[model samples]
Target chain A: MKMRMLLVAAAAILYSSSSLLMAEADGKWLARVPDEDKARVNPLAGQAKAAAAGKIIFEENCARCHGVDANGLHNRPSLRSERVRHATDGQLAWMLRNGNPYKGMPPWNSLPEQQRWQVITYLRTLPPAGAAGGKP
Target chain B: MFASPAFARVLSWAAVFLLPVPLLRAQEKPYFVTYSTDLEEPGNLEIALKGLTASPKDANAFFSPTMELEYGATAWWTTEVYAQGQATDNDSTVFTGFRFENRFRPLPREYFVTPVLYVEYESVSRADKSILEVTGHDGISSFQVNNSQSHPIVEHSLESKLILSSNFKGWNVSENFIAEKNLSNEPWEFGYSLGAARPLTLVASSQRCTFCLQNFDAGAELYGGLGTRYSFGLAQTSQYAGPVFDFRTPAGVTYSFSPQFGLNDNSIGTLWRFKISYEVQQIRDLFKSPSKRNAQ
Candidate 1:
């Protein structure tokens, strides 16, 4: 039991460090957003139906990189992380519109504005990091 | 005085320099036609070397080797340019010509049946037996004659296709309705192509492996000539069906191969085809604004 607890602690430290590194890398990407854009609110906020529709869209497209459960894959950040949870709806929307190509996240501009907002609504419903299961 | 061997050497060297370093988000397209709903990410360039060989019954065999450069101009628009050349047994090798092609998707998101418009302008010699397309080519004798080394008919033609594609349960199906018209005043010719494909695995593995079957896709293509405007029907048509495979490396190089069999006398039997592609830099990053460069 003691060895298992030590291993868990190590994994947690690794996960936290990786997340910090990712946040540092993404700082430039987030900085591009205007102050107004970051503060914008979701027009379709809390719409359960839109979120359901967005779930389908996300599964079709985003699931390849983000994983079927929106947990993330191949070093891709988990959508349920504190960073994603803290990002404003408008900021998230702006990131979707203008992707950080340098970092490999493609712009979601091809999706309709309504669909983008719907995806944001769906994202808002995900459990925060460590709420359901801890990931490293 | 370009021998096939010498040409091969030159092409191999060119491919070495043309192979671009891999980028993170580059998605490898699995098929030439019956394209997946996924589009090339904007600002990326992909290069491909495609080869196809056809042998008609008791006739001289011929093959086409083409080099293609593709650019994603936007999220919905992709453009490509091709340099085509051909070689025939007992015949002289020749550089047929080039073609420019574009594909555009109008819809922003997934639809019931996503539609893409394809247009191409080709300038090739009659001796060009690449058979990249099979339109209005229906006579058993036509294959032998069309591929005759003695005849080099220069043709400037416009080709168009309406591509309708859909995806369901990880399966992608696409159908192309084709139309071609010659600048030399020939009647419009029609053709069709259908493709269905799926990845070997729908789930990603925790460990990345270059030779993993999960990184590969298996598919099939069926295409044929639909006769010309002046003459319509399958009475004189060439049809081909084939199984295709694609292997994508982690470094962004994709290799594709196909073995096509003729379904009719008008078509050539046991045609073998292969293509290798590499992704280049995104156009946006290649030509970043001065302000962005400074910011970086």
Candidate 2:
């Protein structure tokens, strides 16, 4: 009886700890950024209005697959980490204009330039990976 | 004795003049007059002609304003007469000949293969006569005595065609393989086609152009045209020659137009052609619903 109780207690602890670890892993994965070899910009600084407009544009186009809050979806990379934080606005602009064809992303150069900039601005506001309820 | 360049030029001109006038007359019809290049096999006109030549019972089986008559006396068939006076004045041509057709079944029907055949013959009368002839008694005498007299020469032909067709889920697919001999005196030519079609936008009063793979002999065809009211289509044949345009107006009539343009080699001028057609209502009704008549 004693041994059985001990085994049950150990199993419960193991299950809880594993659940916590899985939650942490999910957050990290969702917050991981793309394109690490780029400079960073504070999207919140002088372009708050642009970023606000960008949020709307991003939701209209990118959010369908990228997730509502810019958090990554299944197989899509997050924008919270060093890679996204360090990317230059121009680089993001380029990616938005001419999408990665090989990656099945369609070019949005046909869209207005202001709209492209707005998407870039919105991408900058996503919280980093481990924040509560910030990522999947 | 040698013929000088001057003499040769005169002879050539003489030959061209001496050649039958009816040959040019036959080709003088307006470009819009429909002409199917498939002369070896019985074309729609030929089939109608055959029906007309048959007994009155066969005549009842066919009804068309344009009529033709053909007859074969022996194992070899002879004579093809086409008459269309509705759009012209006293214009018709008769092609008399003996044709030999031998069909060979190399594969089973399950394989989608059918019997193939070869036909060779000499077309006679004005239309079949050569465009050029030899001049002078000496040249004429040589031509008369020579077994290979080029004038009124034999036009040889051999054709192999296989047709496979099937229908699935309201869509139809037809494939055709054809090979011809003596293309402009060249060795032989071959072509194949696969066509698929399906109807879209089913409505009581909707006009939709059916999509097909081989509509214009191309791989894919989408039928929709200006204002979503008209149905227009562009297709490419399997040979990838070029796109052929087909259109239908809101009147529920169908038409096909092939635009051809090239440089006239002799005149160094522009050569252009625009063909248009309107199917007779009787024929159109037979193929489609008359309530949905559209323009071509």
| Predicted model with the maximum TM-score | 1
Model 2 Cα lDDT, one tens digit per residue, B113-200: 2222323332332222111111111111121222223324544555444544443332334454444454344544444444443323
Q: What is the DockQ score, from 0 to 1, of model 1?
A: 0.04
Misplaced by over 4 Å in model 1 are A1-136, B1-26, B138-143, B146-151, B289-291, B294-296
Query: Which pairs of residues have clashing backbones in candidate 1?
Result: B43-B282, B43-B283
Docking class of 2: incorrect
Q: Estimated TM-score per prediction?
A: 0.67, 0.24
* Chain B: TM-scores of all predictions: 0.88, 0.29
Question: What are the Cα lDDT values of the candidates?
Answer: 0.69, 0.32
Per-prediction DockQ, in order?
0.04, 0.01
Write model 1 residue lDDT over A1-98, tens digit each, in one string: 95598478544633443332233225466667789989988887997877776675576457655666777654556788777888889888888866
Worst 10 residues of 1 chain B by lDDT: B287-296
